[model samples]
Target: MISTYRAVVLTRNGGLDALELRELPLEAPGPGQVRLRVRATGVGFTDIIMRRGYHPDAPKLPFTPGYEVVGDVEAIGPGVTGFTPGQRVAALTVHGGYAESIIRDAGEFIPVPEGLDDAEVTALILNYVTAYQMIHRVARLRAGQSALVTGAGGGVGTALLQLLRVAGVQAYGVDSPPKAGLVRELGATFIDSRERPFDEAVRKRLPEGVDVAFDGIGGDSIARCTRAVRRGGRLISYGFTSAVGRHGGGDNVGGLSGLLALFVGTRLLGRRPSVYGITQLYQKDPSLLREDLSQLFTLLAERRIQPLIAHRLPLLAGRAGQELLERGGIRGKIILLRDVPKKT
Candidate 1:
């Protein structure tokens, strides 16, 4: 009999009920591809956005929904090199990661460093890469320059804090009180957005506005973040979790105002603010990935960055994990795990 495995594939989009666990036959890998025995997968808002047909560029209906996976190489196709059977690796999968086995391009895979837990590696890849690219590539802040990050205790925000500290930069984070301690512990000065207006709270500490402003909450908050950036400072716009369901459904989070300000600010300050619709590391520049991953691996090896795992669920329970992510109170990553095969 041919090999077979289970995967979490959505039968449809537009609603949460469409999420279904399905079975599919496993096959040998194509050239430059490897079959991964997926151990863990991270749950991000991108999954939910794609599920709801909100992500403009995502794949069409009835497909597996996961962007990253951690596993061991089960099989390697011809023309592939370096990776061998049972090698621990993490893949920035284009699709099919929420499964017991996945065949993915070798170029997208990275060696999972020894001694780090699977959950940590899974969380680190997506979040840290976005953080690194936005900070080092996009923001390009000078030493001692300060930044204000909204949602500062979330995955990308926390990772940015770690990277910022490494670059000798100071950060002010806006978050709820429950997450204040974690933000402070990450070496960020905290502003409570739930308790006070984001701009007002940020001004109390920053006074003349921060050197950079990193915003994930787009809508109206984008305007506030635009104003908070120093005249010659930068604003890295990355997410729109703020516009998902809560904000009257307008592109309120960093929409037109963000773009207009992004352009106008450049002329006024010489160094202008820019909003990144998506982190381009995966698309425009894949070569930069190896270096970025190596840096993150070094941080992991040195124990300079620690992962906070919010929850882990079975692949079949991916919908539940997405629901937990949508309900929106967690501070870390939710991972989907595959079961180890059982003896007959």
Candidate 2:
């Protein structure tokens, strides 16, 4: 019965002003598709990168910018079975999630188990999956080994810390002093990036370096991480957040080209350097995403890991949420909800 829905549209890459909330016509699901009433969507540094025209995977201008969403199937198109009206589901939207309703291929969404909070489930879709894949599939780190995690208090960073503990890998987390307690509480040895260079501080404690290191800060942070790993160990560079701050956090950062250059530099040093993008990997193997996400859901249900949710903002507040994320110091994922559930 809804005739229109709201979504955040990125008119062009620039500052927070580029993000605009617009009402769009509602369209029924086409064959093989489902129309969902969105419950929650996640916003992170990636959204900031896209807003500043620095994410390689971002779509053309005048597009939505949400990466993941949890919703209820309000309508199902013909040829779609398995999903019924009112069924709860989640999807790795990649874009088009900052909305009240959206239509996408039914295959794009996976059923979300009941009793899990919508915001928490939204957090798992992107951040947790990225962390899970990097540690297990990419690094193949084993128990008793050691690793270092940079940006240890952000969404993916916190997820990485908790998962590293579950894998029984000793972890060293680098962050500002303000976040030391949160990092340490997650069972990681905290290294203050302010005391000195992180790699030097890490070497002071671990003379031989760790078994592996994960760097999402990119830029010069990548080189430091390469040194933090043992001679034969590996370094996985996933994001380029540090670049955002260099030009006032609003100017375009060179996207993947810059990140790749850093990786090549590290590789030239005889250390293994790898880069990861959740959307790129999911596009290649959709089933892998399903399998991994299902495992993460189980872990959440069993309370093996708790996702840190720093802020939950209203749907239309997408711009404000991204601004807060840009300011940094947020300890976890920021979720945008169509409507906040009232406390009982």
Q: Which candidate is the best by TM-score?
A: 2
Q: Mind giving the per-residue lDDT tens digits that candidate 2 earns over 243-276?
A: 6763365323544555665667667766788888
lDDT of 1 by residue, 64-157 (tens): 9887888989999999999989999987765567788888888878887788878778887788877887888788877888988888888788
Task: Give the C-alpha miss distance for residue 118 in model 2, angstroms.
Answer: 0.9
Candidate 2 structure lDDT: 0.88
Each model's TM-score? 0.91, 0.95
Error of 1 at 279 (Å): 5.1
For all candidates, the clash counts are 5, 0
What is residue 292's positional error in candidate 1, in angstroms? 0.6
